[model samples]
Target: MSLTPGLRFSRSAQYVLLSNVAVPYPARLPYANLRRRLNSSSRPRAQRPRGSPRTVLRRASTASETKPAHGPPAVSVPFDPKSPGSLSTPRDPIPPESTLNPPATTRPPPLDLPARGPDVSQFSYLFRLGKAYMQFYKAGVKAIFTNRRLLRSVAPPSGTASAGGALPTRAEVLLRARTRHDVSRLPVFGVLLLVCGEFTPLVVIAFPRLTPMTCRIPKQVEALRRSAAARREASFRRLAHLRAARGEKAAGAADGKLVAGHIARSLGLTSGWWDKAGLDSPFASSVADGAVAFLAQDDALIRSGGGVGGIEDAEVMLACEDRGMDVREKEVGELRKRLEKWVRETESSSEEDSKDKVKRLLLNHELLV
Candidate 1:
């Protein structure tokens, strides 16, 4: 013991000694501890059950919940077959005394005839309606020819007389204008009648512009007026935009040639009657000139005819329509007042005050404000 060597050695020698040594496993562990360790390490994990209590409660709550009602209220009203807006109402309802009886006529029966009630059947009604429409179409065609003849008779021989001749009477002008408008739409009306057949009335009601003025019922006329009012408002907005884009000074010039061009394009004077263009082209200027002349003539005619008061109701409506004014829901008296205002302003203004005149016609002047 007195001569025992210290355990410490040089680093290289200690590393060599440790590298050659072997560690032994413990062989004396207790059986209970070894068994417990093996059982715990080898045991399988327990899985959670499907549809647990919390999940079932959540699903039950959701299923028991009620949703609120949506959309319009459910109060039912009885349908009126006599109403003009009713789908079941006759499109062209004729009384028993009307002369347009299909049975009394010698013409052959329509190719498509409804088999129900002889007098009240769909085919009977449509046949009578067709006859009525044909009557109107025939009248319009006749008037067109008659007006053309009258106009030609009054027209001087080519190159023999000056371009200026006696102006047509107010009646002739009004008749010619109405007939031309109705006749021009005949082809389209015929096509719709052919294609739509029983449904033609519904189509015409929805698109009143497709039918001629002569064939339009009161309801269709009202619908058209409403649509015209919307279009007039749109034109006003477009004019405002144009005025903004061009300087205010240009828009308010004395001659108002630029504004005149825009007004002409809006009034359907451009080629194709739907083209949109500014005063950048010569064609626009020419169209504007034509528009101005037409308006001046109309003004002169109105003045010569004893102002707005002397014109008939139909003539008043036509004038309002031509000038892009809103004629919706207006009575004869109210329309006359509006027209009188325009005429009064125009009377005091010169021909060069075109912008103001057009503005008055369009109802876009300070009067609107």
Candidate 2:
């Protein structure tokens, strides 16, 4: 069973991208010119006395360089040697004392640009594994179901002798089943690993906000199975408890009365509460009409009772406890009685079926173990 051509193509594209990101990126200086300017301003200025001819000459040269080169040249004005007199007034607007020598316009400290997140190359191994797994899964399932006709031929009805020595025997059919089981299981395992490998890193990096739902397909499937078992157990227990409670109520037992009174006390009581405060209620209400219809079988047994007898329903019920309406203790007890009877009946049926299977197996074994 080849992978869907599209999936393979997409996976290949991902690989190319992953590999590209792998080639190390050279360390680059994005703003070298701005950085150089900032560094130059921080140097100390010369502190030579103004009276020195060399210092005076250097200052004059510096001033000449700074002034506009195309403007009119300075004209020599007669100086009163004995009197201190100002020269031509400064033409450029005077900078404010506060602004004139403001701190150097140091380029804002080189922006501390955030580091780029890890590159996609980090996911290559996982991507490859996922691709392989998906391919195997697609093929494996197809292989098994595709040969159903062959499988049917190998598995014959019990007790009927075949022209060719009991039609390869039941044990032979089971062995073939086991082979098919491997074909099914391998792909499933591969898919599981692929899914985990693909998602685990993403969850780790994303933390709380983007955490992957831990229930991946494989884990979810396993969890579903476990939940199914728990559901079955919970149903059985609930039914048994209900039956016992109902019997006690019928017998005028104190426990039954106490439960009913407690339920009654809790019905329809509203209280002041802070916005986030939590409270517990002891009684629950159902749509009375719906409950009647449920009991009346207007819907299928599963739909009406909401899986009261099925594993699926039991699971949903457990999940709803935190959010669902409260139930009256007396009603709960009565419901439990009916469930307990149903459980006993189911168990009895299963036992009878098991007995029948064992007898059939023994009879078949006599001919071909």
Q: Which candidate is the best by TM-score?
A: 1
Give Cα-based local distance difference scores for all models: 0.51, 0.33
- Expressed as tens digits, the lDDT of each residue in 209-275 for candidate 2 is 1221211234333343343334334333443465587674221224432323222222212221311
* RMSD in order of candidates: 36.1, 36.8
Per-residue lDDT of model 1, residues 67-110, tens digit only: 32211111112222122211111224322211111111111112
Residue 143 local lDDT, model 2: 35
> Highest lDDT: which candidate?
1
Tell me the spans in candidate 1 whose CA falls farther than 4 Å from its real position: 1-119, 153-168, 175-224, 242-250, 254-258, 265-285, 348-350, 353-356, 359-369
After TM-score superposition, what is the CA distance of residue 291 in candidate 1 from its true location, in Å?
Answer: 2.5
